[model samples]
Target chain A: MPAINLLDKFSRFSDQWSPKVIAELNGQAVKLAKVQGTFVWHDHAEEDELFFVVRGTLLIDFEDRETVRLEPGELYVVPRGVRHCPRTEGEEEVWLMLLEPISTKHTGEVEDARTVRTYDRL
Target chain B: MPAINLLDKFSRFSDQWSPKVIAELNGQAVKLAKVQGTFVWHDHAEEDELFFVVRGTLLIDFEDRETVRLEPGELYVVPRGVRHCPRTEGEEEVWLMLLEPISTKHTGEVEDARTVRTYDRL
Candidate 1:
């Protein structure tokens, strides 16, 4: 397969909150998503989720701790079973690259309307 | 843990070919490496490695396939058991982010002088 260019991938879709799978290795899926507004407060029971900001600002609000803010080129790993919510501030949309086990549900068990079980491969 | 800035992490080290463990999750390791010259031809028997170019150019030469060239913001996955060698072209050094199983050996089965059995956490 040819190299996957993140900028080119981001140009292919405009949907918000729906992650597009770009690659998978070792049972983990590498995804890209455009997120705006606030996301549901949930956690993967057995999978740690990695959020890497590609553009804009991402603020991850936690239930028991301080909210973590991520800027471009920065990444944060939310441990499994930690309740948290992610949102963008000021920016119209936030571009994010996520790394998580394939078994991880987008919204965990919350069943939010924005939850996407099977991501479309980009 | 605080947000990890890839650029900041890259600034913290300048060693060539030595990968530094930045973050880990789901039994996988997220590492950064600055590579120059050609790496030894080797393959992980049971682990796929994802290489993302952070800066400069990266070229991956495979045993039975065309070489893949990667630029910044581009990524390629070297499948498990595929003999491949990575090298930099033109540029003095290439910065890369790697994702692979935590048990993966630095040089796979090869015992090269540049092989690092233990990676330092940055």
Candidate 2:
């Protein structure tokens, strides 16, 4: 039998930044999302955020002159307490799985227009 | 800049079962692989092992008569102390990243045909 497609699961929903809970491990939530354009600059003070890209591209910009572009199948672990912003180039849609504490906020510290209120599940 | 491709990183080595160390976080090792055929049944007494599939499929057969099939982009976390066997159904190659303690063994208890030696780096 074929297993679940992470992107297909995201396609079932339309909310951005509101990651859907997929799996859990040792108290950490594994979330899948379909993201486009730019996300607000924020920081996860208590936990590191892992961005594993499944399709398209993403550029993670940190506050301190650190900018990393993620390609398909590449994963970047943003350490806890670092300020960062995410943006997508072109018109590509990105598939991402974030591993972190379940209570992590969609936007940290700076209140902005892109903060996701609630997380949805598929 | 484009980030490192996990599968391409595995292409830099030719060892089977012997996983190559990739990134590290909070003292945890993230190792990637290109696997085919079957892996020896094993159990990690302390740390859970996460298998994130990048290409093709995998059948994880557990000792309790339970089986879970994983496909591309789907991740499965094998809880600590659980014995399981992994097998590929066809000639397809599979990409995996195993997250566990650095001291964990490739094989659990039973002396098998697929015990890997020392881990490699790419």
Compose the digit string of candidate 2's lDDT tens values, residues A31-91: 8888988888889887777788877888899878669988877888888898989999877
Docking class of 1: high
Model 1 TM-score (2 dp)? 0.98
iRMS (Å) per candidate:
0.5, 3.6
**Number of backbone collisions per candidate, in order?**
0, 0
Model 1 over residues B1-122: C-alpha lDDT tens digits?
89999999999999899999999999999999999999899999999999999999999999899999999999999999999999997657999999999999999989999999999999
lDDT tens string, model 1, A29-113? 9999999999999988999999999999999999899999999999999999999999997657999999999888999999988
Model 2 root mean square deviation, Cα atoms: 2.9
TM-score of each: 0.98, 0.84
